[model samples]
Target: MSAESLERRTRNYLNNNVPQIQDHGGHFEVEDVDEETGEVTVAIGGACSGCGIAPMTMNAIKHRLPDEVSDISKVTVRQANGPRAAVMPNKTDEMEAMEEYQDYNPPF
Candidate 1:
């Protein structure tokens, strides 16, 4: 349940799952896991940067991450490069934005 252990397991899982992605010129990098909130932050780069299916890929990754690592409750995928800046917003800031948006919007 430690952050280090979760990180190692996540990296191993990514290595196993992402070779084909890398072969396609896409890459996934495990950035950090917050033990306090059980959120895993990942960066997707290379061909995945501007991929049309990036949202689907992100959802797939989000669903898979927690299943693979019991300590993780959620996964956040960040585009390392796209229309957005190379440096992504902090996970906390992203979470806050999502929360604020959700407060004013109804669930689909």
Candidate 2:
């Protein structure tokens, strides 16, 4: 396939998958894809910044992306906020609650 098509495919996949990731208070983005090197860089943000499960999530992305987007020999996951930020040291209960509330849904 052409490089242009490969890039498009990668972008489309990211667009579709990012929302699912965001639902967990984490953000995912496609940073770059090098056609020649076959390296794709992805950025993770929000609650996923420094979370321990980041590796698992990244690994899943790396595996899934290549399956969908051809020519991607490698996937690099970048953290927007450092690992420590994932813990949000200074975040208070009310602040955390508010953030959660904004994304909450009523079970009923």
Candidate 3:
């Protein structure tokens, strides 16, 4: 299949099967496709940055994409976020403290 058609179908598959990703402010981009090797790379971005479940989402993509898209035999997914000046941008101090102490249990 042509690269354009492959990409289009892949996008459609993700949109149809994984609407939750978009619902949660995440998005997937088809970064590249190697027709000969049948490998595709996808970048997951937006609210997926620093998300605890992003790995699970990536795993799902790696397993599902090839099955759903023709000419795709392998999948590679990466977080699209580059280096940030501050970790967890827009996170309030309260949020940070909550995350830091989420597993803590006082002896009481």
TM agreement with the true structure for every prediction = 0.68, 0.62, 0.73
Q: In candidate 1, where is summed lDDT lowest over 10 consecutive residues?
A: 99-108
Best by TM-score: 3
Model 2 residue 18 distance off true place after TM-score fit, in angstroms: 5.2
Query: Across residues 20-101, which tens digit of lDDT does each residue of candidate 1 receive?
Result: 5577688888888888888889988877665555555666677787887777888888778656433433343354357553
Which segments of model 2 are wrong by more than 4 Å? 1-5, 82-84, 87-108
What's model 1's lDDT at 25? 82
Please tell me which model should have the higher lDDT, number 1 or number 2.
Answer: 1
> For candidate 2, what is the TM-score?
0.62
Which of 1 and 3 is the better model by TM-score? 3
For TM-score, candidate 2 versus 3, the one ahead is 3
Candidate 3 per-residue C-alpha lDDT over 8-108 given as tens digits, one digit per residue, 9 for 90 to 100: 88888887888877887878898997877888889988777756656667777888788778789899998896663113443333443676746533121
C-alpha-based local distance difference test score of model 3: 0.74
Error of 2 at 62 (Å): 1.3
lDDT of 2 at 23: 77
The 0-to-1 C-alpha lDDT of every candidate, in the order given, reads 0.70, 0.67, 0.74
User: Under the 3 Å rule for N, CA and C atoms, how many clashes does model 2 have?
Assistant: 1
